[model samples]
Target chain A: MNCQDLQRLVHAYLDYELDLMTSLDLEAHLNECSACRARHAEMRALRDLEARQLRFHAAPAPLKARIARNMRAACGNDDARRWRAWRAATAVSVLALAALLAWVVLPRTLPGPHQVVAQSQEKMVYHIANSEDVATALRNVANLLEISPDARIVVVANNQGVDFLLRGARDRDGTPYEPAVSRLKVRGVDFRVCNNTLARRRIDSSQVIPEAKLVPSGIAEISRLQTREGYAYMKL
Target chain B: MMPHVDAAYNLAWWLVRNRADAEDAVQEAFLRAYKFFGSFRGDDGRAWLLAIVRNACYALRGQAPGAGVNEEFDEQVHLPGMVAEGSNGPFCRNPEDIAIQHADRELVNRAIEELPVVFREVLVMREIEELSYKEIARIVDVPLGTVMSRLARGRRLLHEAIVARMKKESPK
Candidate 1:
């Protein structure tokens, strides 16, 4: 390689972008030519200087959090839409099952209408799947308690819904959910987190707040509540 | 995609020269990536994502009036006093002549920041991020030769800028 060729290929050589034969030729030229060697050294120095001095700006914590939240929101919406469509497709059968349960089970289990008005308690199970659902469930539970002070509310959280109950989980406003969860826990609401989700997501149960009880499976818990405990299910 | 966030942010930061703007660019780029993910054929996810990031940075620059007006690199204007390509004379003075070993972080950073965006992106990708030329070419949407040329020019421009700044700051 000549001086002109060395100058043209030195940067690529320094970058290790050249092929083996070309790289060997460049190195040979560098060994023979002092001027090209000096220039190559300068180029190498600049490259090394840049590697030493250029700051690599990592994504800030907030930015990562924001991107994660956005991704979850997008994916969550897609999942919710798919779930809604599936639910819509099965609405008829679900409605028929609801009617069958009400018809065959209510009269045998409940008191007379006059006594039912005064003595019956409202039992509801809420399914939460994301942060927004957590917020909605919180609002709905609060409203239910206001109307029926003796109401039983169980919030079963799985998927990203479990995040709000995790330690250090925060709302969009940066307020911790611990306070809200603790407040509702004292009000007789049961917050159950899905252990299955924790295992799948590789999260330790210790990471969950004390206010939530870890259930074996959120779906199974919801099923048990609906079938054996006679709780009305609501997905928020 | 999540793994490449840092790489994307680094490229975006150097391209836009601001933390907030870089964050914005990365966010937008990820959103674009997610939206068009169906189109992605599952090659190198980092390179694909970075290409989106580079485009997002340029789009951002285009939106803000006068933000990147001088983005088009003019060889004659930007390479003033730069050695002619393939000439026998030295491409730059010896490293010691410019006191490069003594060039502090701020000096090196400012000199790199002064480079045009086209060159700055390639330099940062190649030098700081240590990306391969083909990967950079894929990200920058340029040919391999263009990536090499830009990297060479970017390094020379950075060296010249640092030298000039050191001379200006010198006591004599």
Candidate 2:
């Protein structure tokens, strides 16, 4: 009923956190006391003001993709997900403990360092989806090599674009893209294919061009590389 | 129903204060949650998921490159240190007129970043995420009273910080 007692319960009252009896008492005190009434109003106003000012920000696209990818892996196969997670973690940490953890966790047939891509700052990933854009992406790759010869480029193929990585697969004009892919590989470009796409389409990995590598998740890999690994993303 | 990843990611983001660390924490949390989904019997998926997220954030305590990294939260120690914001006073200044012009989303975010991790977590969960007190208490593993006090103190500190920032930016 007093000011001190009111202060103790004012916020609770404004937040509707008080019990029925306490709420009634607080209302009675506020009705009798103008100061308590004003305090109640300001508390509510301040709460609303702060709520309006401090907004909730949604997760960015890449982070969501990364999360969904990891979640899907978890829901799919426990052991496989754990192994793939270690592989992804290996991409992040180069510390001794990290290396030790990887060594302890990895199977004897763990993928070699040549297949391991730790994307440094100067690296980029280009995605090509349409047959029509194969030449355009190749041209872009050629232009990129000319502009930044030291750039470590990764060309990830998924969906219909996986054809470009197939052995003897030709461009829209019927000229084989293999020659360009081979030349780019010699120049240090990596061509990664989506295993999910290949499996869904019943294409065997052995049938893929020998130079190209197979990745478990294409969109997820692209998202993780761009978001976490700082790879520049270009869609052709 | 599973909680939305955005909810988990936002909580981690508020705690870690960066996209990379937040993503890592969220990713870890989701994996842990998925693996333990069979053990979860409660209907409050958001709170359960957030507890996992909070655990993941704690795992990144020394590693996260953000404000207040050294201030590991000790409830017994900090319970007395928080300045109690008494809400019993005559309303003199109009709440409308006390606008901090520079209190954009970023400034508000920075203000929140400056708060101690304990208070910051509760405040974000209650205010921005709009979780009930019971839900917050469950997520934080604290009592209802604890959640209320931290929330009140957090608002006071944040309000003060925003006003101070505005004053500092004003022409001298």
| Highest DockQ model number | 1
lDDT by residue (tens digit), candidate 1, B109-151: 9888888777888888777556689988887766788788777
Q: Could you give the CAPRI-style class of model 2? A: incorrect
Predicted candidate 1 versus true structure: per-residue lDDT over A1-236, tens digit per residue: 78767766788987767888999898888788887888887877887788678887778989988987786677686554443233222222222233344335555664322222223366678889887777657866764564355778899999999999999999753769998888778989999999999999999999999999999999999988976886666775
What is the TM-score of candidate 1? 0.57
lDDT of 2: 0.66
Candidate 2 local lDDT, B53-109, one digit each (tens): 888998877533223422235222332213344543323233434555336666766
TM-score per candidate, in order? 0.57, 0.51
Q: Which stretches of candidate 2 lie over 4 Å from their true place?
A: A32-35, A78-236, B1-3, B62-104
* Most TM-score-accurate candidate: 1
lDDT of 1: 0.73
